[model samples]
Target: MPRILLIDDDAQLGEPLAAYFARFGLELHQATRPSEGLARLREGGFDAVILDVMLPEQDGFAVCRAIRAEGDVPVLMLTARGEVMDRVVGLELGADDYLPKPFEPRELVARITTVLRRRRAVPADARLRFDGLVIDPVTRSVERQGEAVELTGTEFELLLVLAREPGRVFGRDDILNQLRGHEAELYTRAVDIVVSRLRRKLEPLAAIKTLRNAGYALALRPQAHG
Candidate 1:
């Protein structure tokens, strides 16, 4: 069973959703306040999180950052129907997916499954495929649209990091530690520079998306065969 945590002020939504979720073997836990929600999350053991954009205490973005700082848990943000900025900010802040309000409960379940499906505990092989983009970690190679995309060692590692978990956002410091095993420098723009260079090589295929004030994530996958 997947244990899903809901951080929202609407206590009314819990019982019904919990009952509805139970049919699929999902256990639902609700926390109305961000502080309490964070505490519960810190206690651990949640398959995914459903966070509301509007909260009593800290907003969902802050909560999302805190969650991402701890680990790569799949987060699906609930936002207003037209809050374009909120959705962008949420994604930038490491939200695995987002659900605008006025949605059917079944749609929420579908979104949760979609995000989780992209995340596998172990790759079936060293080759990772997202749509038409293929990354072979063993060979340290990347291919797009039947052509090769050459990347620097750092760039390849960075791409590999983001591609490992398609929708998970990675902060600059996290990338630094993974790539160079050190802290990020205040004056350094190395990560940005590398990303820019990489973007050039990976043209026509929008594989990476930048999350401003946060980091980056892999957005595009290889297209499926007809």
Candidate 2:
């Protein structure tokens, strides 16, 4: 069973939600406060996190940043229904996905499944090597110039899509489709935010190239192997 941590201030949301999640073979844990949630995460063993934008102690964005700083645990943010900025800001802070409040329980389960799938996606080859970068699909790890580059689940998936086919320009829709494995009501700018973060992590190498009016491509040439 995949363990998930939910950090929401709603005292009533956790028990029922956890019960519903159990139907899908997911073990859902709850924390009514951000501090409790962060502490549980530090002890590890969670596959993903469900975070609500409105919380006591601090907002969800701050928790997302703290989560990203520590590790690449997959994060699904719960936002105010129809609030675009909430979703955008969560993504920018390295959230793997977002669901609007007042959501159907099944839809939330589906979102969690999608993110977990993306995080555990395995490529055909063992490792992808570029001029100054290396990606090991099995380990879901990346190295830039032989230095380990920690990445969020979404970031790693985006880079995998581009790195798998070097120099192929992927449109925003194309990248989104490949990454999400389904059509979503997300903005194309989401891709740009992820790309920006990825570019920063892969600095000095210019591993990803952007084409105006198009999408992004891997700029690094494959490292020759003997």
Candidate 3:
């Protein structure tokens, strides 16, 4: 069963949605406050989070950003405003998807199912040989020259994005959008931070290449073989 954390102030809406998801074999954990939600996120070991944008105190955007800073859990944002800017901003803030208020329960279930499916579909191949480094995405592990190296969650996601498509020149915005999910807030240096962190971990192998202002790409060293 997939575990879901729902952060919304509207008890009426939350209750019904929780009940609806429960019928589908999902375990829903509800939190009406931002602080409580964050706490649950850290401690509850959930698969995904459904956050309402109009929460008291910090709001959903802040909560989402904070969570992104910690891990890459899929986040689905719910906003009553339904404005394009709001949707864009939510994507820029690292939310996986966004749904406007007054949405159908079925639609919510569908979105949740889609996100979970994508997350689970990430391949478990023992090793991804990119450039000179080998990455095991399933285990969150990496190896260079037959030696293991440590990487943080953000670094691993960044590397996974680039290595998944070698020679592809992904723009910073595109990389950020991909790794952070569709609903991340735009930041001038967010991609740079992730890249910089990745570089530090990959420096030993020097497989990842920066494409000047275009973005970053992964290229295998001529002599390095799988």
Q: Which candidate number has the best lDDT?
A: 2
Model 2: clashing residue pairs?
Answer: none
Q: Write the per-residue lDDT of candidate 2 for residues 99-211, one digit (tens) a residue.
A: 89899999899989999887776767768888889998889989899899888889999998998889999999999888876657647989999999999989988888999
lDDT of 3 at 112: 86
Q: Is candidate 1 or candidate 3 better by TM-score?
A: 3
lDDT values, one for every candidate: 0.76, 0.91, 0.76
TM-score of each: 0.59, 0.96, 0.65
Model 3 lDDT, residue 18, Cα: 77
Model 3 segments beyond 4 Å from truth?
122-124, 132-134, 140-165, 168-226
How far out, in Å, is residue 24 in model 3? 1.7
TM-score of 1: 0.59
Query: By TM-score, how accurate is candidate 3?
Result: 0.65
Give the total clashing residue pairs for model 2: 0
Give one digit per residue, the lDDT tens place, for model 1 in 38-103: 899889888889999999878999999888777667788899997877876775665656778977
Q: Is 2 or 3 the stronger prediction by lDDT?
A: 2
* RMSD, every candidate, angstroms: 13.1, 1.3, 5.6
Worst 10-residue lDDT window for candidate 1 reads 180-189
